[model samples]
Target: MSTAHDDLDNEHTILPSWERNAYAWTHSVRDGHIESRRMVTDGAIIDVILDGEPRFVLDLGCGEGWLVRALAARRVRALGVDAVSDLVAQARAAGGDFRLASYEDIIAGRLSLRADTVACNFALLGKDSVERLMPAVASLLEAGGRFVIQTVHPLVAGGDHPYSDGWRQENWTGFGAAFPSPAPWYFRTLASWVALFTRSGWHLCEMREPLHPGTGRPASVIFVLRRR
Candidate 1:
């Protein structure tokens, strides 16, 4: 039986608005002081990857490849893939290994790169993207490999915004002119996130809500999953 979520998944399409401000977004997080990243996301994701001790990591939707550079510094083999050419170019300029490929291409069986761990940081924004990428993620990981995702905490993301399964425009309040055409992202509740992972044949292994250092509020949520 197809549920409402399934119906919505089939209807939604990928948004390319991120490409508009790719340069700005890349530069913003390059130094890693962008509130959320500095507060918790950076440490949380790196800790998970180090704990897994994987030979290689495939950073899906790796905008600008900051995480890839970080992992490479630790001598961990890491490759970043993103749809935006400008972002990939910047990553390469920063001495990071990055490929220009979209999630659509990956889901369609176009790219054939596998790794022991697949990490997506704050990139799973759309329901359609998630639905399409989940199966491809399974194919990209080795046996017993882990998939780590760090995204905005639903509770925090949905505080003022509606708490439903739909797309919402980014609050470009603090981003300044760097983020001109902010892209809208799909907001999924905690339960919805877990349900999507479960249906995609992933076992939820660990979950954490990293708090903001200054405000002490939940900044983002990290989920670690292993293929079942």
Candidate 2:
């Protein structure tokens, strides 16, 4: 739908230790509200999908493993994975079994197990990573399993300054998302976002644009994808 939103990959590491670095940035900016906000949003999504039942889950990019703990508390079989080792260890200690590896390495063979749901919440990597990750997400889901993702709203990513349009970005892996420059993010429009799901062989079943607490404008777009 969108020229693949594919055909590109990052040669650089982007941002090393994204788990810790992102948390640091969030804590700094959100002033201890990052975790709470993430929990509320993520829990809300997970709840509707499960419908008051215990669902087997894989928490992708599961930093600090908070969701894993939440799922486990609800008697759900929750497994967590992250690209950062330290985060994995901390996650494992918190509750569920956690692994430190990229999505490719895990899905390649090591953790080839499919689950009732695969979730990547509040962890929007650049385009290349998302492209790479989505395929694996599809593969790791049982028929009818859900693939839910919450990313930075593309509108929000493209900052709007009064005088200028802000630095426009056509790609997600650009300097901002991959660095600590406090740079603007590269968000996906609603149409483009749906196009990605279609191209990836998934269908969007649920959608929402919950407004930010302070800002009256939309804060985020949430999606629930099912294998086609």
The lDDT values for all models are 0.83, 0.62
Candidate 1 lDDT over 91-201, as tens digits, reads 899897889998888888888978999999988977667787887798888899999999989888886756777677675655434676756677888999999999889
lDDT of 2 by residue, 73-142 (tens): 7788988888767666666665677877676675476677888888887665555556556666777888
Clashes of each: 0, 1
Candidate 1 C-alpha RMSD relative to the actual structure: 3.1
Clashing pairs in 1: none
The regions of model 1 sitting more than 4 angstroms off are: 1-15, 31-33
In candidate 2, position 215 carries an lDDT of: 66
Instruction: Determine which window of 10 residues in candidate 1 has minimal summed lDDT.
Output: 6-15
Q: What is the lDDT of candidate 2?
A: 0.62
